[model samples]
Target: MELKAISDDEKQRYKTVVLKFLEDLSYNLDDKAIINYINKLKKEFAPKTARMHIIRIRAFLKFIDHPIANLIELPKVPKRRRRLVIKVEHVRDLLREIDEKLSGPYRLKLKSAVLLSATSGLRAEELYKLRLEDIDLENRTIFVRAEIAKDYEDRVTFFSKEAQDVLEEYLNTFKPSNPLFSKKSLLHQFSKLDTRLRMKHMRKFFSQQSDRLGMPTAVKKILMGHSTAGDVDLSHYDFQDEEELKKIYDEYWKNFRILG
Candidate 1:
């Protein structure tokens, strides 16, 4: 794929992993050296992380026509259980903790982000790249633009009445035009690494909430910006009306409200 085809976030991650590997290892790209590098990665990273880095390395080696690329076997990554962090009370506690830790502008920013993510099921990057025009407070909808989406497919997501109230206040106060979450401004007071991890979990919370509400698997995937194109009938023949989607969204999402 062309450089422009992938999002900057993904590219940056790949670059970081590759650079770290290069920095640690000598120039020898033989089977033994590669295996040693994999061992070192396995020691430092989780199995998933190690596997991802190995995949990237394998791709790069293939692109370069390296001989050892054929000899490299991918690490066997065991299936891991997903951590369910979508309990409304747990999310409320986290939001409260964030409020206690952060002050002034950034606190509100983070609160809005957490709330929005829980309600809308947007990926972190999608939330970051959200434009002012993408939000429709009147309609209670957020348009995840094609350009910012991980799959490069455009879709719509909705926020709850509670989330709409908070989001409206945030938009009025900050008046952000382009990027909704500006690291220089909104994240100025916070550790970027910590905030990034929190945002990731928040996205997972959205997915879990969707499941808890008994949303159809296809609808849940659509709401989460995950590709539903895997099913030919659902992708091409089935037409989901916006009103039907909104009804489904509202039905199960009301239970997601953060309780005191």
Candidate 2:
């Protein structure tokens, strides 16, 4: 599943299958034992979960066979794609809760990371690809290079004082030249505490914030990294000045109490 890398519960599923079929088992009971295991799982879990559990078991059982019993066959359950995405409010809550509960550098880093994503509409991959050079604190701009972006185009996004302060503090304490968005980019000291939050929720929350602020449709689209194929280019239109952009960003942060 696509969630294996991120899902907290997936490791147990993989281990159960490998451990059951490959470890200290008699050859003659293979087929019946596999069937019995499936039955037991079916009784204990829902049909859907039973199927998922079976996949892991079957994958490991594919090569092994018993001397007297025929090998068990697995049912191929059609994979269901997860369409549910985290809501914007949830993202806001996550950041808020983390800010209130988490302590020290880890707290500031997470607060800044999620806030940056929500405000700038950066993707998880984009967050991981950030470089120290990408952000210009003096100029108050973040340069998202084309190579790391899906559209193969460069874009500039601005930051708020809270983000700037956290980042500046982080930069002052940690010297990193390579990856900007990953946990390792923070510092060896924070490595133990870094908990990588998904970036998609940040983008979603940003969109909601933009909507609440009555941000122009075009500006919202650009901020969300969505461009209409036939639409006129935004850069070709009149662009707002840095001061105007700052007002919008500041107001957004103000509402969330992130300005403090």
Candidate 3:
């Protein structure tokens, strides 16, 4: 592998997992050793986490062209029974909780993050990697750069005015030079919240609200930076026009707006 597209945190995770595997198992990369290590992982970690560890280990083995790579089997993980649906009320309640629990620059940072992610459907990594230049307050648009984007493609997406207001306040207060938010610090503060709500759920909220407001599926997918590789309409249709996208987002803003 090519790792240029992987985020720093992802690379670190892969490194940590591989190192742990080497430390716990034999230095010699053998099929038996790998299987034993995976079994130990299943015993020590949750099913999904164990599955992830195996995936990382398998990637490393394949990178070195080990014959055992093809023989390794991933442990089964239980599928989710239902998808978590986020609503405007949940976001409102969370923001109220944040206000009651936090203050100063930290409060504004988290507020801006939650609102932006909720409105723009940005991934946590994408939100963390955003820079001052990537945001256009006047237009209420965000530019997801190719390097930071999950799909490794550049895309412009719009945010609600409610998000824009808080974001503008945050910028004026902190005036960051680059890399608008610290991923470590942001995640640390977010963990302090008492709710089970997560940053990823904010994106889900945006998707849910967009569908509820009658946004075209292809347009919604484009806004979320999803790949059009297999989609017939998205792959062949011209839905990349920034102005047109902004107009559609504006039309649905009333229903999608999370705050006044």
Best by lDDT: 3
Clashing pairs in 1: none
Q: For residues 1-260, what per-residue lDDT tens digits would candidate 1 score against the true structure?
A: 45557657788887777777666666666767777888887898888878899888887778779888887777778887866455777778777777778876577777888788878888877887787788888888888888888888888888877777777787788775677775455445446323334666777877877787787767767778766556964564236877777778888884457744
Candidate 2 deviation (Cα RMSD): 7.8
RMSD of 1: 3.9
Angstrom error of the Cα, residue 81, model 1: value is 2.7
Consecutive 10-residue window with the lowest summed lDDT within model 3: 251-260
Top candidate by TM-score = 3
Report how far off residue 215 is in candidate 1 (Å).
Answer: 3.3
Of 2 and 3, the candidate ahead on lDDT is: 3
The C-alpha TM-scores of every prediction are 0.78, 0.54, 0.82
Against the reference, the lDDT scores of all candidates come to: 0.74, 0.62, 0.84
Over 1-260, each residue of candidate 2 has an lDDT whose tens digit, in order, gives 45434344567668766576455355334556667766777788766777777777665555344342334444555677864445555665666666676677566666667767766777767777888788887655778888877777776666556567667776676554567557454334234433343555677666766776676656656545565566676653226564665565556553443443
Q: How many clashes does each candidate structure show, in the order listed?
A: 0, 1, 0
Point out the higher-scoring one by TM-score: 1 or 2: 1
Off by over 4 Å in 1: 1-53, 183-197, 230-238, 254-256
Off by over 4 Å in 2: 1-93, 96-105, 183-197, 232-256
User: Residue-wise lDDT of candidate 3 within 26-91, one digit each (tens)?
Assistant: 587777787777888899999899989999999998989999888888889999898778878999
